[model samples]
Target: MTHISKYRMKSRVEKRIKDNFLRSILSGGSARRQAILGELLTQTEKIMLAKRLAMIVMLENDFSYYRISKTLKVSTSTLKRLHRHILAGSYRQILTSLTGNRADAIIRFLEKILEFRMPPIAGPGRWKFLDERRK
Candidate 1:
């Protein structure tokens, strides 16, 4: 395809992705979302997307490239590309919001499981070791 045609096709696909049906399906509860994703995406595609999200979260948590790569089993080049996207600010806000919500949900779930509220971390520096850990 020509460059202009490719751009037009991309835009059309973007529009389709943003359509109400897809939005509503994705916005459903976890089970429904999982079902839809299972039907729509191949297992490999789902795994890759999960890994990408994990990388985004790890990057947001101040994890280093080496640590993320080692833990996620992804290459340095992939991490660099993700870092560029994060730095470019296209996915930063959505990634941060999604990660924050997920973190809160995990904390709540853990609290429910343990039958007690977990103490908050003392300070920002408390999590500095996360960079050193394998994850």
Candidate 2:
């Protein structure tokens, strides 16, 4: 019967997925990460995904205003604003100011605006805004 055949096919595909997931977990990718990804694939919002990806590209690099603008296909002014935001804003605030909505400067200048005074954490990529939080 067609129903029986479909069930068998689904079972086979699920087995392969389970096997691959087991291997990934054994390699220490984190059980949470594996579980979250394994919960059936789904679609994402294009704009939000693009914004988050752009944020990642900017954060992961020692990028200039012009460089980030070019890479993210946004205007130079917009990139400047994001730079300003990173310095002046908290994590939640930065998330809000995404998409060319905010000024660019060394993070120190932005920190001055926010009156955010915090001690620095030691380590690579420790505190996000170095120019602001670091000596």
Candidate 3:
């Protein structure tokens, strides 16, 4: 999870900075936005953001908690928190905009990457251990 400092900024100062930051991001083209994010976020932070987006997409699809927890390797607590956010309409606009194929593609891609495991060795039985059902 992303961390915030113990120190707090004044509400007005924070709001002004947040508005400017959002304006900077929203004014950019897709490539520029990607570049800015790539420069600003660490790999772990990027992965966390991606997984959160994937989790939101999965939740919108009405996937069961067990399947989502298993597939995303996220805690039930995290899912529960996000689920509450969803119920409160935190993701309303984004979910509405990403309906149908786009949402499905994101889910499929997330599953593909998260479920993948490297082969243990280069042999006939190399891929056997990669079978998740065996575990």
- Tens digits of per-residue lDDT, candidate 1, 49-113, equal 87787777777767788877876689999999999988888685667577567955644443343
Taking the tens digit of each residue's C-alpha lDDT, what string does model 2 give over 28-128?
A: 55776656555633344444455444653455345566655554466777666656666665355444554343323333343353465454667665566
State the lDDT at 12 in candidate 2.
80
Clashes of each: 0, 4, 0
Our tally of clashes for model 3 stands at 0
Clashes of 1: 0
The alpha-carbon lDDT assigned to residue 120 of candidate 1 equals: 45
The positional error of residue 53 in candidate 2, measured at the CA in angstroms, is 4.3
The digit string of per-residue lDDT tens for model 3 on 11-110 reads 9999999998888877869999888888889998998987788889988878888888988789989999999999997988888988889998997886
Candidate 2 runs further than 4 Å off: 1-45, 56-60, 92-135
Which of candidates 2 and 3 is the stronger one according to lDDT?
Answer: 3
Residue pairs with backbone overlap in model 2: 80-103, 80-104, 81-102, 81-103
Error of 1 at 115 (Å): 25
What TM-score, to 2 decimals, does candidate 1 have?
Answer: 0.59
